[model samples]
Target: MNTHTRKLIKLNAREGLGVSIILVILFVFLSVSSEYFLTVENITNLLMHSVFVMLVAFGVMFVLSTGGIDLSVGSVLGLCGGVTGWLMMNGTNMWLAILAGLLLGTLIGAFNGMIITRLRISPFLATFAMLYIARGLLLLFTINEPIRNFATPEFAFLAQGYWLGIPMPVWIALAVFLICYFLFNSTSFGRFVVAVGSNQEAAHLSGISTNSIKIRVYALSGLLAASAGILLSSRLTAVQPLMGTSYELDAIAAAVIGGTSMFGGKGSVTGVAIGAIILALISNGLDLLAVNQFYRLIITGLIIIIAVGVERYTSTRAKTA
Candidate 1:
């Protein structure tokens, strides 16, 4: 391999090492502070809970890598989950309902992309509007009632089943991470995303279809969010209209903590997986410590702020160097 390729690999390795260190530090601290933190059961449960966040984080990472954001993901999750649950409760085929939910998510994402790319709407504004719209639709469909009677054994297995001694969600999460890692690291589409994020105008000048890329990214984001929703509903054996409220923040936190620049053009799928784990550890640890939910939210916010601050500092240092 060439020197440039070697240097790139080393840089990525360093970044991965940095994230690993943070994860280790957090794990050790939690284990020390809470007697039950290292228990096998707790660890298993933590991984299960984190799967949804990891999936959503992967999607958000894609949008952020393209210098865009999708604020509607959480709402889309709720809507899709609600729809799926409602359908199943009403006797629809399980696989068919799931596919319908995923399709709905993709369509919403496409709409968001179309408005932002073709109509020149800002990503934030467009997705912000979508957030409310999706939530409203969720409430309308469920009529504010949670769907609980649709938990067929096969349906519940999607989230709670075991495959070769590992939770099904863990395997699913790993598959998503691997797929996204390949897409972001080894594909021409990934290169296009980076180029567009680094400079949209320049990418457009070079004949890259920036609009199409943005649309595709957002659609992927929606699809992942829907998948998360499906798993969540399965885990709970119910789907509440407001089930995904505030989840977007967690996904964004994961992406940012994983070293995805808010300004775009920098990200790592592996780093994001680690970030999701860190967030899960924090939540799990706080619960073990009997910390108040309110305090947990405050602490999570603080962590996001600190992570963003560190990103800015590192970016500035790199620019100067």
Candidate 2:
């Protein structure tokens, strides 16, 4: 109805279109690359594999929307899973152990956010510091050893069980998507996030409480990171301190590829979901085709570069026109 509303809507439409085009291109490329790429089984496998990255990407989307980054997510996730697995092994209640893991993740997130907002440090530096801190804590908790979850059937089921032939992780991912859709589209906080990203000084001047928003985004990111860790731990039946090493890069890559601007203030969880799926499908299809693993990494890097270029071009064109 208003000019501002109209602009936001248009921006969202362009992002959605970009995601659709990306999905189509990926579909065509993978389908042509390997005969097994479009099979029903492979598609499901791809979805399952992508769920972890998708979960992380969704949360990363929120963080990036607020013009921040969480490089510590990967390590925080690994540490949470290792801590939970160790607790379960020591005879803790299953639910309590999971809660503990989530709490640990939240605390780590708060620490990162506080350090950034309170100390006026850049998010990159703050989260980068926590990345190593989390990894070291994880190792200390497990005594530099892998923690097993053999005695925790319930916990394992969180990652391993399926209903009606669909993996629980897939369901969890879907639920996360729906929740994020609402959080971003229907809530006051979501609008604040956009405002803060668009112009932090204006937001602060308007009494928008930018610091609190930053803290919330970081904490949410941590929660998602922990969820990914829990599901991964369940499936693997073991938690290693190094489990999520470099995964933050994948999450960042997915968000960037999904039309989320690294400069901030523009992106959709839905688009990021599609981006995560695209990455997952590429890896899965490549494995099925027996392509070199190293080549896959190369292709991934190219995709990120192209996506960032596209975002920049679109933004510049919009600005000039």
Candidate 3:
């Protein structure tokens, strides 16, 4: 209806296309370079590995959409998984242990929110502090050991089982993506998130409770991260206190690659899902090519930097337009 609206739409489309093209090119290269890449088993493994990162990416996308960041997600995931495994090992009911883990994760998120919003701490600083606190508590609980319990068949099924030839973890990931997609695209709260990210003062003047939204965004991020932990532990039937080290970076990279703006107010669940797949593909491809593990880390870091640079350029162009 207007030139400005058309330009905004075109810009968003361009951002989405950029990530999609990268994913496609990478996929094609992997498929062509590795004969095993297209195998059913390898594809299944790729989806399974990507599921956890995708879950965390969804949480990151939400926080980024609200112009906030939470660096504690990876630590919270480890802590939740460790706690749940510890509970199960000590003979707690599987369902109860899972619930407890989720609760603790949500509480940690709320804590981060409180400090950042109420205490006027920067989100980066607040969540950075939480990262250490959560990891420390996890180590204290587990004594720096992994929890292994053989009694929880039901819990194990959450990650390892299949329904109609699809892994349970994939189903779980799909369910999460659907729920988040709906929340981000069809809800008043989602609109509020975008508004707040775009301009806090304007959103506040429009009667939005910016603080409350930020708190909830962080809490949701924690909840999702906890869920990822649960699935990861279930898949391994064990949990280590430091299992999720550096996972936050992967999640952030996925969100950024998926067209979630670092400056906020823009994101897409579909894009994030594709981004997760791309990361998983890169890892799998590298492994197939017999690349060094250390090199993989370097490549991942480079991708993150590149994605952020692209986001910055796009944001600047949009503003100028």
Candidate 4:
């Protein structure tokens, strides 16, 4: 094979190895640290909890592949859930309400894309602004209180129900992962994403529609965030004004910790799945060990910092080599 193909394979191998090693280390640590961590029930519960973040991280991985960030995901999650719940409360059909919620998320993401591509706004500024706009909209709808009394038994099943004894959310997450894996590994869109991230101007000069890619990436991110919101809301049977506050942090952390480059042009669906588990394990193990819950946030921050540092170091080494 060609040098380029070999290099690409090597890169992917390194990315997977780094994160897999971390996963193994963390898994062993958690297993040894807490007896409950090794139990069937606890492991299953932990996997269930990790799937939500994994969904969001998948989208974030896509956007990050294009060297962009979507700070609006957390708010998108809340707003989408609120929209669906509000519709249900007003007698809208359950399926339609869920569809509307997904559509809203897609539109918000598309809007963020338009603003960035058409208006030439930086992704950070555009998405950060959207973060507040979406959050404000969510708060407006649930101003008096959370949206409730709308979750039908069927609706509750979206998150809580099991398929073949596996949680419904697990099935949903697995489907999403498969789709993302196919997109990232076996499609032109994925190549374009990497090319654009590697050098947008060069990609554009080569006839790539860089703007379109950015818009689509952001929109995909929004859709995944919305899916997470719907599932989370269904499980809880309510949508509060601030249902998804700061969830973006978890999403970002998962993506980065999974070996997705902060600088872009690199990401892994498998790594992201592992990263989500690692992040969840931190919170779960702490809970089991009777540590302060807030420490999870601190640990997440540290992990992100360390991950970024490692990315920078490896990138520099590759360039110098």
User: Clashing residue pairs in candidate 3, if any?
Assistant: none
Against the true structure, what is each candidate's TM-score?
0.94, 0.93, 0.92, 0.93
lDDT of 3 by residue, 110-187 (tens): 889889899999999999999999999888987755688644768888999999888999999999999998999899
The list of candidate 3 runs beyond 4 A from truth reads 1-12, 144-146, 307-321
Model 1 lDDT on a 0 to 1 scale: 0.88
Which lDDT tens digits does candidate 1 get at residues 219-300?
Answer: 9999999999988989888877789998898899898888887788988899889889888888898899999888998887
TM-score, predicted candidate 2 vs. hidden true structure: 0.93
Looking at model 4, which ten-residue stretch has the lowest summed lDDT?
311-320
Candidate 4 structure quality by residue, lDDT tens digits, 178-268: 9999999899998899899889999999999999999999999999999999998898888888888888888988888787877788788
Q: CA lDDT of each candidate?
A: 0.88, 0.85, 0.87, 0.87
* Candidate achieving higher lDDT, 2 or 4: 4
Model 2, position 160, has a per-residue lDDT of 80
Poorest lDDT segment (10 consecutive residues) of candidate 1: 312-321
Scored by Cα lDDT, where does model 2 land?
0.85
Candidate 4 TM-score, C-alpha based: 0.93
Top TM-score model: 1
In candidate 2, which residue ranges exceed 4 Å CA deviation? 2-10, 311-321
